[model samples]
Target: MSDFRADTVSGKLTTFMHRARAEGVAEPVRHEAKRLILNQLKASVGATGQQAVRLMLDWAMAEAQGGGGAHVHWFGTSLPPALAAMVNGALYEVLDFHDTYIPCFMHAVSGVLPAVFAEAEAGGHSGTAVVDALAIGLEVELAVATMLMPTGYYRGMVPAGLTGGVGAAAACALLRGLDASQTQHALGLAMCTPAGIYEAAGSHTLAWITGNAARTGLQAAALASRGFTAPPTAFEGDQGMFKTHSDEDRAKIDGILASLGTEWRIFGQTYKVVPTETITHGPVECALAILPRAGGRVVERIDIKVQEIVVTIVDGRRERFGRPSSTPQATFDLCHCVAAAWLRGQFTTAETSAPCYTDAEVIALSDRIKLTADPGRPTFEGCTMTVTFADGSSESHNVDYFLGTPNARVPDSTLIDLLEQYGAGVLPAGRAHAIADAVLTLDTAPDIHGLIRLLNKD
Candidate 1:
């Protein structure tokens, strides 16, 4: 395999940006991307008041306002675009409620858009430009993430912060109309600002890293727009990103970028059927879907087959499973998800965030659940669930795909309804409806400023 780590990956990124900017995206894909963006905006805004989100936004807003370098529009408020991007990015991720891709372990849109929106708004780019930038950033981030999947990096390393800076840079380069060389410079600048850590997973640091990635990505790209430059060999060469942050599989890296435009990475973006939990646990949801059949009273032993990485992240915090104190803990807890599903018959944002997380009954049930990695199952998908009852009867269900994913796409109407459901908690009913409508109609809008404005409407 060729050493992609030693090659000019930044230059390749520049070339790809040129092709993306010049060729542009298909109308259909652009529309889909807009819809996804709208969904993410709603999700982020809805999570704005969350404790982790508030902390992240507070820091980001202070940083941008403190820096006073640029003015930008925040999604839900009149904050600077850079600040807004950072805060909104953080908010979107606070609940870990945003979209995720299985192959790359990347939180796809949320990480890139905050920066993209910030830069686009700051630069006064058109909605079409915003969409283009968003698509470019999304593609680049997904490409990098897909290239590095199944490696140790997937454990807790935020792919968004790592690759998102590059994505944001790509978007900024495209939006700013930078040339190929300048785009390379932007990418290099982005790589310098790789921000994320697995240690922040169970804490508020996850949101901070996400928001920071967005802000830094925008900063990097914005710098490149004005002719600022950094080391050209950021992604490749001896002292590059991969050698330091990840185990570089040169073949995978090259292959990820090889079939670029011909194969759309946008297709890899998967929406969430359930608003909580990481994408790695989607199949757990599939298993939980059948728990209602077992009857709430009879579930004696619950055995779940999950990916090893899922087990690692979820293993810690068994006490949380038994008694979830926070929304983040409840959502990320396998015991909570399954226990709630069996007891309440559903897994919605409301259920996970409910006071029931601390309820004795839920915790009692959670204690009965057990999760084990299925060696036969791929890390990306597939989950088998068995519910053995006290009545000497057992029921098992296996789900190959979650509600999201290309294999089982959520209906547009249903997804809209789900967004409305989430938005209703934070926004007025009419406002939520309008937001959903605006998202669906985002493609035809003149600019995302209006969309951003719409998202912030309480």
Candidate 2:
């Protein structure tokens, strides 16, 4: 039994995987992983037409020209699974549409899945194995993230990409069936590659950084599988991952991981049902439910009160919540979300596309909106809004938590609905349902790649 420090991503991952496997993952855990994987697949495929996606695919294809070891096929290409995993993972993240865990505060799945799928396909692992690996990766990433999240958000570390590196490595290690020693080393190898900045949140590079983690993780695990080794204390020792990235309280991460066996961390993984924006903005969507209570009154003033992190992340943007001109911008900008929802009377995914681009009212309303920071609240909470009408009336809505937290989790049916709607535009309708059903029952499936194959375009 190794004792790991609080800030060490590698230490937390190693501990959680051992515990997750011991407790025996529940069916709901696998189902959630399936739902997230389906979402990532759709987002990856949809990204093919984006300029960033094309650019990344071009570079990846060039990288694919020569590689060794196993053939890990990507989703949309004839390339081997490993290479495809790199591309697919990158694509999933290239758009920043993948699921995120708030506790660990990282984009865990996007980076890890490509590697898991690649290895699962290469070695012909069962869907159960893939599901287990995903759960393990997410669990580990979230646990480590929880410790690092508090201080890092203010210090400029992009928690998702930072912790995602280790998660990706863990998933790949699971796929490769690596021993514990190798697993630890693979994580160490990944810790050395963590990259991404919070400043990049609004830009196209955000998704690519996430995907890059996948590629890096897969390569690290593959190298380790072939008897490569790195520093075992990659995360823990002096001059290591935490020392370089984190600024907050040191021991919080370790204390959380210590609860790994007794507490199932997967239960903490949050899901985003509304495609509106970032994790901080999820509560804003719920707050929008109160607009009708305002009696459709014209608002003289609108004030959004959120944790300081959200204010810092979204306030400076030219149109953070207005209609986003690009895909990347829409995820973080709350102004675009509020403007669209108010103008259209609904904020569907399509609204984030071109139609919202042409709406003048959304633009005008976005200009009127003002955002204020609440220093007293937690970043995960205080995503609230207040509207004051021209008449002598006002309404205040406070979302103490986001929609996808353990207390306010998105239902399984809602997750299924989201998958169907998100995938229906690209994949056949029946195929979308099948993807959901198959994912829900993945534990009994023959191989995980079978589900990956179903995600292919006809």
Candidate 3:
């Protein structure tokens, strides 16, 4: 194996992605990649009718009214490659049900999948090619994120939009069969276009950040493919990505490069069983676990002790916890999710909507929940919940790992079931099953266009 760390970060990544092969990837890694792809498709199809997705599709379609390029998965429409990527990417993230990389605090699939799908459809690439590009894209995104951590989110910048653009660009470059230099230029161009804020959490604009990242990335790769030039040191120079976006004087660039092809971070990605912020999942699980113990007794107060990250991101918005006006606000509130899960026994996509958010019973229970940061708790994956009944009795439950974490990964059957459930809302049962089957065996499919076609609603 060559020393990928010896080259510039961008150069090293370009070489790795350009040379990546499906056959070279381990079976388990490939399986995980397929699951991630399927998860993204499931999210896209599930959120097809969302107001945010509809708005983005309308805008993208209008932008590409005369020039058609590639298919937008599940929408049965074609737009220019960049516009298609934008719509598909927005759909993947609009529901906040996509896969997440814990280390980077980013949505791993939404950012990269749209670019890969768009480029593959436009170029008529194979499923193997799409898989390879996805793996490469994830690797680059994870590595960069790992290096710039402990600051991006703290500074109000959304990691998915900040780092996702470069990841999408890398995937597009690989699909376009660009040389190492061109791929480097693509990353450079993408690095200059980062735009997403933590404040977008409770609005439709949050999804737009994800969509814009996908579009910008595909556009960057397209420009690079056409001999566009960018500085070679776009990621490491005095005014590079790290300097501009990170508070760290020097990022762990060496460590990021050294682990390029040796480690597969995709295996560590977690699926969102609930349609809310990933940090709230543990608390939601805790709430559900204690529900049975509480029996028919009325709950008086619930105290939740979570990690610092949770308090920073989910607890600050106390006003929205009791009564959220929208799905985004409700999903961002830990108390709202816990209350809903406790009352309904499960948190599904429907629970994140306006009707559920404004439920009188849910609001009453949510108002009683109090959240506090546990300084000793190291990560946001675990939470301790104590619920006191009206009769003064109390029950406590601690959750160290949620359902979709690496330790408690959702089974393939559960994933298929989720896909069927979500897909059935938009697609026929037969079509949903067909789409699932094709995605499960996607590695062997001759062309990715067939898979995209199956995703269309008949």
Top lDDT model: 3
Q: Mind giving the per-residue lDDT tens digits that candidate 2 earns over 277-326? A: 45435545744676678776887767787677666666566533334667
Ten contiguous residues with the weakest lDDT in model 2: 67-76
TM-score of each: 0.90, 0.87, 0.95
Ranked by TM-score, the better of candidates 1 and 3 is: 3
The TM-score ranking, best first, is 3, 1, 2
- Global lDDT scores for all candidate models: 0.70, 0.68, 0.82
Quote the positional error of residue 116 for candidate 1 in Å: 1.7
Best by TM-score: 3
Give the clashing pairs for model 1.
72-80, 72-81, 73-81, 76-456
- Angstrom error of the Cα, residue 397, model 1: value is 1.6
